[model samples]
Target chain A: MAALSPPYLLFLGDSDNPLSIKIARGLAHWRPELCIGETGGELSLGLKKMTPAQGARAGAKTFIVGLANGGGYFEPSWVGPIIAAIEAGMDIASGMHQKLSDHKEIRQAAQKHNVSLHDIRHTAAAPPLGTGVPRSGKRLLTVGTDCSVGKMYTALAIEKAMKQERLDVDFRATGQTGIFIAGGGIPVDAVIADFIAGAVEQLSPPADPGHWDVIEGQGSLFNPAFAGVSLGLLHGAQADILVMCHEAGRTQVKDMPGFPVPTLKDCIDTNLHLARLTNPAVKLGAIALNCRVLGAERADKHCAALSEQFAVPCFDPLLHGAGALAESLAGKEE
Target chain B: MAALSPPYLLFLGDSDNPLSIKIARGLAHWRPELCIGETGGELSLGLKKMTPAQGARAGAKTFIVGLANGGGYFEPSWVGPIIAAIEAGMDIASGMHQKLSDHKEIRQAAQKHNVSLHDIRHTAAAPPLGTGVPRSGKRLLTVGTDCSVGKMYTALAIEKAMKQERLDVDFRATGQTGIFIAGGGIPVDAVIADFIAGAVEQLSPPADPGHWDVIEGQGSLFNPAFAGVSLGLLHGAQADILVMCHEAGRTQVKDMPGFPVPTLKDCIDTNLHLARLTNPAVKLGAIALNCRVLGAERADKHCAALSEQFAVPCFDPLLHGAGALAESLAGKEE
Candidate 1:
């Protein structure tokens, strides 16, 4: 999946932990016009921090890394700023699980600067296994109650409020900071537990029952370490809409101390009972939360008491933008 | 994990599918004194068939590949009989997914007969992730309702009926024909979906409190392509006894056509509710089943009607030898 090369430039190696630079705060907050800023950390994302030869003479074209610890290693003082961003011509992506071409000075300076190194959690072939087979589309997903609870910022704020309600959505990405903010996905936890639900059924395939997709979710079927990549991304997301996402007052389970953090009505009733074994009319539809530890009037009274105790549309999709969870999936039941 | 050099020999490569030679009928039915027979298929685990130079002149010492099929490739007509069992001196194991050192003539005939190839579904390091904490001892696992049902032959017949009731058992293995009949394991679907429950919590760690371990189990939380490696091997098998297994008339979900095959009381109440997220005293201690398509009085009246409908002890741990499921886990409650 090497097509990466963007304006990028992030590289926050010494992780001053804003949850280890969440892939440079998810590409400076959702591909801020292909972000050409930020260098090491203090956690800024307020853009302009340059210096990989001043963001390769301000044109950038990829140099990402953007730290995401807990074993997606690749540190050694970020290999001299990634061979000085491959000697300043750029190209060297990384959503790490180590392999900037397994670092021999970033693979001979990206083969003597002809650049290209992507490794966005590596997946090229080997996927086909999952066949609960039903796919037609109109997905949604999100799920979570642990492991960085925001499920990729409530699935990119419900794919930007289902693309401002005109629908036919997309935001699929499944980690490595939503595959470097949707440049591409399927890192389903660096796949290969027999192809995490066949790489989320080849990252949300069969679309167009009025298309939707959305997806992005992982870890936490009461996470005892990535509930089997969240039950193979809920049986390869045969999701007919789920959402859930939680984090408000999380009580344990992030670094998995003793476990806890389940109840968002037992993680939306065990993710709609294992996503009804590959969507038997799955539901849940909303609840996002991540009230960044509350207090916007207690995160709007804990999202209106969990939208009246799980009836549905709860909020805080990064401070309420999933437009009431895209108007409860445009009033579901499709 | 290596260590394989057994009397082995198995091979059965032109797969005449007895479920693709379930790892040479699980090492000729549970390590028939470290098996020293059988060659290419004609389905006979009745032993003595020899010819990898007459099973290395009857001293064998590893030639395994006992076939599994479904993408564990390595076939080009079994690479000339795995380079004629590495030029007959042996050392070659393989629970496929390719890699018999990616066959350059079986890695130059095991580097010109210095032997050793053992890719029992490769796993060397990088495991640590699952920290749902709780590790003490007494684990039991063996889940399933699909994916080669008889979770590793009911966890090797409950570790050979808890070592013929002297207890303090061990077994463990996670796949690749239970790591070629338990010489080693952790191939948890060739790990890395964020380390399938930390490689089954480092293949059953923290032993001694009346030690049990058992473990072996993969794929099937009602199998939508391996319910996330059966929910990360039920939260890294913090199992305080689970058994479950099932097969008896198999309904569906093996080659995944329209799904089905779930109910044995919904796969033991969803594997004791996702194995109580790192086992909050998990239970359902029996019910192995695999009645190999019945008729021993209909598999003992279908294991006495599922042992009086799930009040546990169900049977057929290879036609009744898990000594009443190890006396229902030695009358449980621990």
Candidate 2:
């Protein structure tokens, strides 16, 4: 929950897989203005490649670990670069499961230089249990058919489109990458199971009736590994609008073979059924598809077919932007 | 998770509410042979009223803090009693959110006596992520229409009945009360949200084909505050047989004022539907009703009506001893 100082120097930590550097990619794409330079990875953000010292000299306020491996580990090789960043007088912020302060060198360096270390994954104190009490404010939640199926992107896009239309809104991040982009957020997945919904309830508390909290969703309700987190998010969200996000052609849940992705209809029905426990009037606002694998024509056709089938606006938020989806919510109660 | 040494002296901590001492009540009711004496509460377990020193002399190996309040807190008043128990040469086991070791006096006393302090609510290391892959062995899960609707009681009853019938069975606990009764369990709700299912999966690993792991379910899938925990338990359980537990005449979820308790039919349909994600062959073996509020005749009539309605055997597991429900599962695949 540390508020990270921006103008970050992203550290990619030599991860070769494109998926591993998603933290860097997401930051570069969403909050490009806050990014100063890049380090370690061959992959480019079209930003200047600079060492921690050089980036610090160039006015980068924080050094960010922009790599997200499977286990969220702090790799040994990354320690040198992190300490260098601390020596250069830049504070360190990480979304990794391992706390930066747990490392002796980094902890001592940060103490000596008086630089703050932000571990976004670790919550400071236990959040209060969810009361299921209805709170004021309009909220839109982007749910997914599976993990990494564009829930965060769709949420961000909706927030942007709503803002452009002069609607009062904010994108509430629930994951690490989203946290970095938004500068602060509750890492919902890392929270204790009993407090997952409570944490979400705390994160997106009552706001102005006209304001929208476009909450980013987590795992799918069908996913065996994380359905709990997903359901907690749904209950705590108390969303007036739920935007379903799904990949166009993916069949199985990520890394979970033999468990097929739930159909959009099934997803909509289940999410609505569970969400109604907290917010009785919750409704499906739109379908946000990750059509990255499809050609433009095919993606459009797929979206149109889904829209007709589900009787809701459907589009790839990243590809087409969320203007239509935002427009669909124009008539909802303020 | 700590494996508590038995012959316990249950400490009720002066809690007047019967519900608050459910942990002690449950332990005494289910495993009376392991309990030595009781202290500090007017409510009788029909055991001897003995001080910690007297209980220790009577061969108590552990002093159990048997109270479970709204918030799992360590009351200042209970500190002296806990320290007394530790000084009396007994290991201490607590299910409260506050660790017994957190108190300086308690820690020093335990250290001086060389007695272990077990905090059941805290896991030592993170569990692996759930893989969603089906594992061997037959598993039965007891799900509910709301929290505290006798899911644990029903599961324990089934386990006992199965054992009496010379069937291969084990009662797998997931909460603190159940954990104390079962000696050890994962305390699934205290685990990280992402690992709720994973912890369950670890707790009930693959066993012999004929062995049955009777996994105790957590919160109801219909409870707004805890449906996520329920869903995770369902998925990780991969139960071949699900016994639906409901308290008769209850109109709303526990502690949540407005959310209505899901009907038996809705509870069955939804639990089976969600549980099928990890367990496709799952079946509703029986309905276990908590008919404590009804007269014997009325309870029988209620069970009979529900049995005929759902086409599944229905009975109060505690009242009727789960024999019929055990017989209903006689033909399940081994």
Q: Model 2, range B1-334, lDDT digits (tens) per residue? A: 7588999999988867788788888999999999999988677778889999999999999999978877788888889889889889999999888888887888899989999998888877889999888999999999999998999999999998887777889999999889999988998998889998899899999999888999999998888778788888899999999999999999988899888898888889999988999999999989999999999899999999999999888989878888887765665533
What share of the reference contacts is kept in model 2?
A: 0.82
**Residue-by-residue lDDT tens digits, candidate 1, A1-334:** 6457678888877766677887778778887999878887566768888779999898988888867778777878878988998898888888777878877878987898898888887886778888878978678788888877778888887888878877888888887778888887778888788888888888889977888888888777887888888888888888887888877776887677777786778778878888888888888877878787767889999888879987878888767788887866666624
DockQ of 1: 0.32
In candidate 1 the C-alpha lDDT for residue B21 amounts to 86
Q: After superposition, which runs of candidate 2 have C-alpha atoms over 4 Å from their true positions?
A: A14-20, A39-43, A51-57, A69-81, A87-89, A331-334, B14-20, B39-43, B51-54, B69-89, B108-113, B331-334
| Candidate that would win on lDDT | 2
Weakest ten-residue segment in model 1 chain A by summed lDDT: A325-334
The CAPRI quality class of candidate 2 comes to: high
For each candidate, what TM-score against the reference?
Answer: 0.41, 0.93
Candidate 1, B167-223: lDDT as tens digits = 888898887777778888788887788888888888889977888888888777878
Q: Score residue A42 of candidate 2 by CA lDDT.
A: 70
- Ten contiguous residues minimizing lDDT sum, candidate 1 chain B: B325-334
